[model samples]
Target: MIKVGIVGGTGYTGVELLRLLAQHPEANVDVITSRSEAGQAVADMYPNLRGHYDLRFTEPDADRLAACDVVFFATPHGVAHSLAGEILDKGGRVIDLSADFRIRDPELWAKWYGQPHGAPELLKEAVYGLPEVNREKIKQARLIAAPGCYPTAVQLATIPLLEAGLVSADDIIADCKSGVSGAGRGASVGSLLCESSESMMAYAVAGHRHLPEIQQGLEEAAQSDVGLTFVPHLTPMIRGIHATVYTQLLDDAEVDLQTLFEKRYANEPFVDVMPAGSHPATRSVKGVNMCRISIHRPQNGKRVVVLSVIDNLVKGASGQAIQNMNLMFGLPEATGLNQVALMP
Candidate 1:
């Protein structure tokens, strides 16, 4: 069995990783590190995993983590880079679910994250871990950087159009919204039940950190610099992300939305391309690593509307991380991730 270690195993993504890994037959979660919750049973902190994992959380120790074959960094942005070098030096594979190595341009990363990169030399080596787009690269990568939740949903929804040369690269606009759980499992005045419930407001309108990451993916797919205007909003729900994307058609020819989408994601296991005019709800993908998307063509203009939905904590975070791990370990991509959406 492939030994696995998780750094920062108390947050939403970390807990979700534990949930998925517990059922992963080929993998063994040998260590879980948490600064504050060290020495506490993981089940004690998260009652949901009481019977599944009786392991106790430990403090971050590079020497201890180097023993594992693969280590997952579910910590904040700069935290992974601080410790990744030692792990990589020990010939251990790493999958970071943070922004530390996602953006290739170190200057851009510094601009958005508001500090210089901790390890600039390693920036060129980290592979962006979006299986749909970079599966081949992920197979050979020693360090895999998982994509952000918003970028994951938005890119899957619009990339096929950009790659097909069917949409104007400069005219694309993404007005995406995510549930409160995307904010993480932390206590905050803004994330309180009453504060977020019955309220809808847009934040990070001018510049979201995910903007550059999304642009990087689209630019690579289109083989050109793609300009995108991204705006993120917060909803009252507990999970999922819905991205409503608009783009102008490049040519006047008749386009079959369903045919195009179906053909694009035909071999992809987790991406579902719905029939034309079918609206997909968040409940359809909750607790699963599925991205449900549909499209529409308006008569007024050559404008195409696409709706994409995914569970921010699942497809957008931990589940996708596990998907990358599966690829890295030469296991079936769906080996430990064939979970159906948990519906109410």
Candidate 2:
């Protein structure tokens, strides 16, 4: 069994990890840490995990964490950097669900995250954990940095066009909306039911942190510096991300956009490229590790619109983390991730 330890097990991603790992045949939840909730039963805090996890939340201890075969950091951005190296040195692989090691450039990370990276040296080695884009690297990675929720939806929608060189990279735009759960389980005025319900508003229009991560992935696909305008909105729902991506086709490029997307994700188990003209709903992917996409070109015009949706906490965070762990351990990529999305 792959002994696993999780840090910050009180958050949404953490519990989501617990929920998924509980059903994983080869995974064992050896330890879970939450500084504030130390000594509390994991189930007490999150009733959904009551029967699945029999462990209690422990304090974040590096030595204890290092003892596991793999450790997942489901904490905030800076938390992973502090202990990932120690775990790696102790022969434990790490999968971080934070922005700490996703961006390669330390300066860019600092600019957006507002602090010097805790482990700049590891930046070079930590593989970006988007399995569709970096599967081979993730399989061999000792440290993995999972992409953010917004970036996951945006990149899945845009990468195929960029890779085929059928779309203009200079003017890409992603107008994305995510549920309140993306803000984390913390108490915030913005996430309050009264504040978010019955309303929709866009924040970070000037600049959102995920912008750089999205650009990084797209630029890699395009193999050039990409000019992208990314805007994120907070929807009133609790668990999904809908990204409406817009890009102009290269002049006179008469490519079959639907076929291109289908072929790009043909073998990817988690990415579902819907039939032509299908409009994928966020709920279709809720609670599952799936990204459903639809392609369109209004009036057969030069501009193309792609709709992408995913359950933010699943594909966007915890479920993807587990997918990376499966790769790192040589397990089937969909081992414990085959659960269907929850439906109304």
Candidate 3:
């Protein structure tokens, strides 16, 4: 079995990791760390994991973490960098679900994150972990920087258009909405039930941290700089992200948008290309590592609309992290990620 350790196992992504790892045939949870919740039974805090995991939370210790074959950093952005180098030095691979190593430019990362990067030198070595785009690279990487929730949904929806040169890359617009869980497990007035429920509003319109990450991925796919207007909204739900993407078609030719999406994701195990004229709903992908997409060209106009949906906590975070781990360990890409989406 591949021994696994998780740092910061108290947040939404952290528990989601535990929920998935509990059933992984080749994975064993060796340690779970939390600064504030150390010494508490993981099941005590998360009753859903009671029968699956009998482990207790511990403080983040490099030595103990390095002993495992791989470590997953589910902590906030800055926490992973401080401990990743030591784990790597001790011959352990790392999968970080934070923004610490996602962006290539350390200066840009520092500017958005509001602090100096803890390990700028390691940025060059950390591979961006989006299985659909970087599957081969992930198999050989020792450090994997998983994509953020918003970027995961937006990029999957629009990358094919950019790659095929079917759309104008300069005028791409991604209007995305996410559940309150995207804010994290922390308490805030903005995330309160009274504040979010029955009310929908956009935040981070001026600039969201995920904007640069999304642009970076799209630009790489298009082989040129892309101009994207990414705006994120907070919905009343608890989990999922719905991204409505708009792009202008370069030619008025009769192009099969459905075929384009289906062919692109034909071999991908996680991306679901829905039927033509279908609108994918966020709940359809909840609690699973799946990105369901639907493509449309209204009134046969030059504009194309792509709707993408994913569980913000699963496909958007922990589930994708485990997918990268499976690739890194030479296991089947779907080894532990084959769970069907949970239904009501």
Candidate 4:
């Protein structure tokens, strides 16, 4: 069994790791850390994990964590910046579900995250954990930087077009919507049920932190700098992200887009490219680690639209983290992550 240790095991992503790892036949999650919740039983905090984990939360200790085969940092940005190296030094692979090492340029990361990059040195080798794009790299990676919820949906929705050069990368727009859970398990006025229910408002219109990350992935795919306008909206729901992406089709691009998207993700275990006229629903992927995508071109015009959906906390966070762990350890990529999506 692959012994696993988790840092910051109190947030949504943290418990998510616990929930998913519970079903991971080859994984044994023995250590879960939380400075504030130390000594608290994992079951008491999350009833869903009551029958599975008998462990209690403990304060983080690099030596103890490094004893595990792999360490998952479910903490926010900068938390892993301090301890990941120690665990890596102790010979444990690290997969961070934060924005810490996702951005290649440290200065750009600092500019957006409001703090200097803590572990820029590790950036040199940290592989971006999008299995569709970096599967080979992840197998050899000691440090994996998992993409954020929004970036995952947006990039998957647009990258195929960008890579084929069938779309004009000079202008792209992603009008995305996400559940309140995307805000995390924290107490915030914005995430309050009364405040969020019966309302939908777009935030970070000027620019979202995810903008640069999305652009980076698309640019890498297109092999050119991409011009993108991204707008994120907070919805009344609790657990998914729906990304509606728009782009301009190149004048000579007359290939069958449905086949293109289908072929692009045919071998990918998690990305589902729906039928030509399908409009994937976020609920279709709720609680599952899958991205349901569909392609559209209004009136056969030059405009193309891509609709993608994912469970933010799963495919967008912990599920993807586990997926990377599977790759790094040579386990099947879908191990412990084949749960069927929960429906209403």
lDDT of each: 0.93, 0.93, 0.94, 0.95
In order of appearance, the predictions have TM-scores of 0.98, 0.99, 0.99, 0.99
Q: What value does the lDDT take at residue 55 in candidate 1?
A: 95
Positional deviation of 245 in candidate 2, in angstroms? 0.2
Model 1 agreement with the true structure over 1-344: per-residue lDDT tens digits: 98999999999999999999999999989999999998999999999998998799999889889899899999988999879999999888899999999999899999999989998889889999999998999999999999999999999999989888888898789999899999988899999988999999999998999999999998988899888999999999999999999998877646776798999999999999997779999999999999999998878468999999999999999999999999998999997899999878
Question: Poorest 10 consecutive residues of model 2 by lDDT?
Answer: 81-90
Count: clashes, candidate 4: 0
Q: Give per-residue CA lDDT, model 3, range 28-123, as digits (tens).
A: 999999999989999999999989988999999999999999999998889888799999999999999999999999999999999999999899
Candidate 1 TM-score over all chains jointly: 0.98
Ten consecutive residues with minimal summed lDDT in candidate 4? 85-94
- Candidate 2 TM-score over all chains jointly: 0.99
lDDT of 4 by residue, 1-48 (tens): 999999999999999999999999999998999999999999999999
Q: Judge candidate 2 at residue 272 and give its lDDT.
A: 97
Query: How many backbone clashes does every candidate have?
Result: 0, 0, 0, 0
Structure candidate 1, residue pairs in collision: none
Collision pairs in model 3: none
